[model samples]
Target: MNDDGHPTAWERGVLERLLRDTLIEQRRARRWRIFSRLLTVILVLAVLGLLSTDVTVPQVTSRHTALVQLNGIIAPGTDADADLVIESLRAAYDNTHVAGVVLRIDSPGGSPVQAGRINDEIQRLRKLHPNVPLHAVIDDICASGGYYVAVAAERIYADKASVVGSIGVLMNGFGFVEALDKLGVERRLLTAGAHKGFLDPFSPQHPEDVAHARALLASIHGQFIEVVKQGRGERLKDDPRLFSGLVWTGAQGIELGLVDALGDADSVAREVFKADKLVDYTVQPAYFEKLIRSAGGEAASALVKSLSTTLRWR
Candidate 1:
């Protein structure tokens, strides 16, 4: 009877150990399932909330300085993109309680086209919202396309040591001609237009293309100068180097008439605009984006945006 029916002590111990491990694993799996369910519910609720939420210009009860910040490179997809900036500006302008609009600028400049659109919008908004004055306050730097946008404001203010001007237009591209030749690589770009492929980096540089590019740059430069002249009018000094694509400190800019005075946002709001209360009117991303961003999907969003080509104006 003992040989046929009795179980070994080691075998029973092994069975108990296996039972414990299995229970532990089951508990772990249960916890994971519960966590996943809770996470899913929370996400669904969040989605519902976002769907119900409206993205609109917030109304202010009191007269305050509406701060529209041009914070980064003014390109198509950036925060300082013309579309976003113009949206912010339009909201600021439309606000009944907005005493004055302050465009807080800090950039090394980006797309000239984007900047020009923003500048033009500012001018148009000025005419529409004549009661509310607009002023540009330079923080760290406002150069090139940044300055172009700034000029649209009625008055430009900056800190004494702040960088103020680069009033220039530039198109930058890399040249791989020498590297291609060294690597024995042949350039094979076919274009329908005669001059379409002239700027191809892998191809040999031609004098005619160089001359044409310079001419194009000069024409854009002339447009930039005309804008500055119109904006500054009699305030600008009679210095030939003013539009020579040279950056200047705010103090130097004041002397050259690039910046009107030395002041910060606080000073501009309190002393200049006479409104101590500052209200930010920057166009921010919707709640869905912020939620996705918090849950580590910002890279996914950026990747989706990067499917299109990007052209930079340096």
Candidate 2:
């Protein structure tokens, strides 16, 4: 309505500009929609590809050294748990193209139960696949439960300076009775059995409980010694201090008959297996799986910490 009830030129220009901007916005939205659809498609394809293939290692047709890594605490929920390690071992032994299986151990040791399970599985697999020998290659430190599992291998190899060997059991806890007394605090614990709270850290030390614990530890230690003897056989030297929960360097390990030789995975793979190429068979958990496992592990640790005032072979 510039002068006579008709639209002005400026108003028309403004309307045209608004329409142009609207069209441009619509184009941008459409482009973003297309990009989003493409991204979704790509994600779906990637997930399907992972689901179709082995979750552990890529399939190889050529003969190579099959590698399984045990690179953490050997607890139930840890990466070096018996289930995962044993599963990888099974796959490696089942693979006909695998020249030899290598257990790349870089752990400071953990639960005895988990270690024992892995050790048992390795021995069973060894007997089943007599041709494919399994070897343990220590990276940094393999002590306590780590060495227990390593002894099951056909041969143990380590670097000259790698820390190895801690062949003993331990149960660690803090006695808070003195602190409680000093603070004038009393622990009110109730149990059905007389010896139910025998090893409670907040309670006074009981001689009978201590004796029982020592006996139990000795029993487990004897079992550990038997397994070591069985695995190393004549290679292990008859030393009284060998099972005294002492850690030794890799060179010392070789001298004390704790380690078979001083060699790394690369040299062993090249000379022993004659296959320079190595194929990993360790199971890598998915993102969600890892999240769930982490949560569960945290819960378990809290529970164990609260309740485990007794012995542990760590």
Candidate 3:
């Protein structure tokens, strides 16, 4: 009627319907809001309950214990730190209730000097505490220097599937002089001594230098073999290639006398120590320190790889 024609009943009906629909939506939204609030309250209560719950770390009875965790690249503060490992061993050796020591080793080998230091320290501790039983439980890959360290233990235990033996030294690198020649890149290396840059990749490799380096590595390898013999004694088999830079599994290693038994840390502890409680002596790195260390390790490893590769190329 206002537009110019007639009264519109249909329009009035449509407006009423729209108003009804809007009201229904508002009610649904209010209900959802209430449900959401209730859910949040319940979640908060659950969290508080969990927080208030009493939880206790495992404990040992009438026993003093220590656990030396061998983790990372056998470097300082990286689980396999020699200084930290020896300090823990000393503490456990001195503990009146300990009566035994366990070295929980999980390493892929590392610095010879570090491993040697640990081996020597263990020997010293053994002399100081002859009554204390020292055991090595290989968790995963215990090879080369790791096996060297294990030889110092009174006995070694490992799982059947564990990778155990790499009873030799290895120095790996690459040579890329041909590539450089193709690219027409000149290498400039200066040294006062004639043999100072003997293995320099940029410089032509001399047969004498190659012989010298091989001899040096061979000497180191001989020392490693001697130490292994001193540790395992007659247990080692009559294989010339036993120390020939080969790896073996724990099962095979046991047959080859590389390890004492086929079992894990828990099995060894329970069976040998007659107790279930184990203490870890490895220092726990702070969160920030661990992060920084991880970054630093990556960079150092990269540098070493680069240098070794560059040398081999030349």
**Pick by TM-score: which candidate is best?**
2
Model 1 TM: 0.76
TM-score, cand. 2 vs. native: 0.79
Q: RMSD, each candidate, Å?
A: 7.0, 7.2, 11.4
lDDT of each: 0.84, 0.86, 0.75
User: Model 3, residue 175: what's the lDDT?
Assistant: 72
Best by lDDT: 2
Give model 3's TM-score versus the native structure.
Answer: 0.75
Candidate 2 stretches with Cα past 4 Å from truth are 1-54, 289-310
Residue pair clashes in candidate 3 = 67-279, 67-281, 158-263, 174-312, 174-313, 175-312, 175-313, 176-313, 177-313, 201-314
The better-scoring model by TM-score among 2 and 3 is 2
Candidate order, TM-score descending: 2, 1, 3
lDDT per residue as tens, model 3, 184-262? 9988888899898877766677899889888877878888889889988998999876887687888988899888888
Candidate 1: the clashing residue pairs are none
lDDT score, candidate 1, position 85: 88
Off by over 4 Å in 1: 1-56, 286-314
